[model samples]
Target: MRIFNEFTFEAAHHLPHIFPDGHINTRLHGHSFRVRVTLEGKPDGKTGLISDLGTVKAAFDSAHEKLDHRYLNEVDGLETPTLENISMWLWRHFARSLSGLAQVGVYRDTCGEGCEYAGEYEIERKAA
Candidate 1:
């Protein structure tokens, strides 16, 4: 079975070193970010659930608090804050606690752009 949870956050960021001086990403801007965290596992016979929504949502609380209505560039490990980077950052955060984590999806809804990180790869790599 697979389960997922999502949350949104508002933040501003500038890709200074990541982009050229004349590029638009070098200019500070804000975005409404939508994130989805997916997990996969076999349902437990007693619980009949792979995992509960509460646990998934609880996993998002700390991440949401850190990113919401803030400057992403100021956040540790998020200085660049591109879609790909943001997804990886989230994967790292949630992977610490959620063993079933499968993937992390980060989207800039306004721009219709997004990225998904393979959480399982990181999990397996770490175990190895």
Candidate 2:
């Protein structure tokens, strides 16, 4: 079984090389970023839930603390903060705290663009 939840945060960023428009590429912009984290696991023998919502909320809360109100480019690993890179970063962070994660989607409303990464916490299949 699988369960999922979404969380939102705000961050500012700009693409350094996308264009020299001065306003779009140079000026800082913010977005009401959205993240969807999906988890999969067998229900606990007694609880009958894959994982409690509170447990999952911890991961989301932690992520918000790190990303919210900070400049994306200023973050440790986000030199550019493109949608694809942001999605990958979210996957890396949240995947460790959950048993199974199906996907992570990140949206940058400023540019009207977003990216999604699937199979983030899925078990790797070995070659036969």
* Model 1: residue 57 alpha-carbon error in angstroms: 0.7
| Model 1 lDDT per residue over 1-128, tens place | 68888899999999888676999989988999899999999998999989887998998999999999999988997766778778888999998989789989999888989999985443222221
The CA lDDT at 37 in model 1 is 93
lDDT for each residue of candidate 2 in 11-112, tens digit (9 for 90 to 100): 888897666777576778878898878787788999798877777789888888889999999898677787777888788888788777777888766667
- On lDDT, the leading prediction is 1
* Pairs with backbone N, CA or C atoms under 3 Å apart (clashes), candidate 2: none
Off by over 4 Å in 1: 120-128
TM-score for each of the candidates: 0.89, 0.79
Give me the overall lDDT of model 2: 0.79
Alpha-carbon deviation at 63 in model 2, angstroms? 1.3
Error of 2 at 9 (Å): 0.5
